[model samples]
Target: MLDARREDLGRMLRAWRMARDPAALPGPVPFRGHRTYLTQLDMALLLGVSERWYRALERGEDRGYAREMIDGVARILALPPRQATALYRGTGHQPPRRPAGGVRPDAALLDLLHQQRRVSWICDQAWDVLAVNAVGARHCPWLARADANVMTWAFSAEARYQLRDWEARWAGSLLGRLRLAWQRWPDNARLDEVVRGVRREPGVAELWERTADTRETSDDAARPMYFPLVAPDPVDVRVAAYGRFGDTALRWLVLTPEDPTVAFP
Candidate 1:
């Protein structure tokens, strides 16, 4: 039975890989340097494993690949969430738990994000910027990037200028939030990758080592956050986050100007 399962998984993976158009995968389109279907070599490269290792798995000669590797393969193939979950189960590995709330935002949430007056955006538990209003994009240009992630921006060189108090206001708070997320999804490869990138920064690494037990406190009293904008003085805004009810793994963040009379452009 084990042998049969491995063979079936290998065949399925091969078919999935062959069916995808290299030009149509998500994110930035790869340069069409060569006309080819996503090959075994491509899968190997994407998963950071050798072609031989991937071939062995595909040939039903190896069924010892870790869950992370299986997941990495699923992502590279752009498998739908359900198919990915099925693949994990078919391979005799447990799939990662879905976010408590859900995966995709509902119509109402989308409408709210589109129509909100304030700078509002929705991010997943991984801090992946899913949807952002025009106001939110205008205030924080980084939110519009292909790899728009809160943790990535916080430790970037640009953060030094964009965030008024990087250490006190941003870094510590972001790290604490990430810690909470880690507690919930400890096996998340993307989250682990973000932390690894952060640790490369000396200052953030020190803070992460020191604040293992620290939990970030919410600022409900409308504490001011300064952002360098077009105005002569830095813009003062108050940020708040609301988790979506039910099984949606989404959070809405609103950034309102500190001065109620002043509206966001």
Candidate 2:
């Protein structure tokens, strides 16, 4: 029941909007910061095209928009190139050839992850192990044996022992995100593969069969869980899950303590 043209424009606006950085935008920071303030004129100038032509393209009234123009607009908006291309394609426009540079972490990102003494790791939207810091590696031995998967860690016997309240604390949150993923990227092949793989993992398989619903919102705080380290007392860690789309293949995750400790203090 949705108008195709309107939907395309709306998606273009949303993708471009969310992709911008507040600090990078002009002005003294508007109500919602930089992303919201980037206007049609700005988009036009960024694409090196006329305002009229850009507006027509965005409005889905023009089919002659150049692929280079869309690429330029995506670059200026900091939109993930793939999603940006999808946006253009939705509007019946031809997108540029796909870039061959698949999700390679630069030296800077590698260094950042390697230097983190805290239990921190990075996973892409498709749940690929882009990088894991040393402390995170120590905290998660599975990171060594195989690739890192947040879901796999939650379901394993060792991890379940570490996180006692697995169902109450973890399942709902992860499932909620999975539902959101299903809605956002219905045709995502990688996501489908991950869902199938997780279902095959014992505990995760059981949860997949269960018909229960739990919602995860950005405002919700992570449920507190204690992990028994070799130390005399259990290390209390607050598990927080956050998502941002920069490199479509990169999502940063940080797990820190509710109270300060020597190493993380």
Best by TM-score: 1
46-91 per-residue lDDT for model 1 (tens digits):
5667889989888877557776577667655767767777678776
> What are the per-residue Cα lDDT tens digits for candidate 2 across 86-177?
76676666654443123555666656666766776666555655456657656565443223456556556676666646677666677667
lDDT of each: 0.69, 0.57
lDDT of 1: 0.69
Model 1 clashing residue pairs (backbone): 101-247, 101-248, 102-247, 102-248, 102-249
Q: List the residue pairs that clash in candidate 2.
A: none
Q: How many Å off is the CA of 215 in candidate 1? A: 3.6
lDDT, residue 243, candidate 1: 71
- Model 1 TM-score, 2 decimals: 0.59
Segments of candidate 2 deviating more than 4 angstroms:
1-101, 203-214, 217-233, 241-246, 262-265
Q: After superposition, how far is residue 122 of candidate 2 from its true place, in Å?
A: 1.2
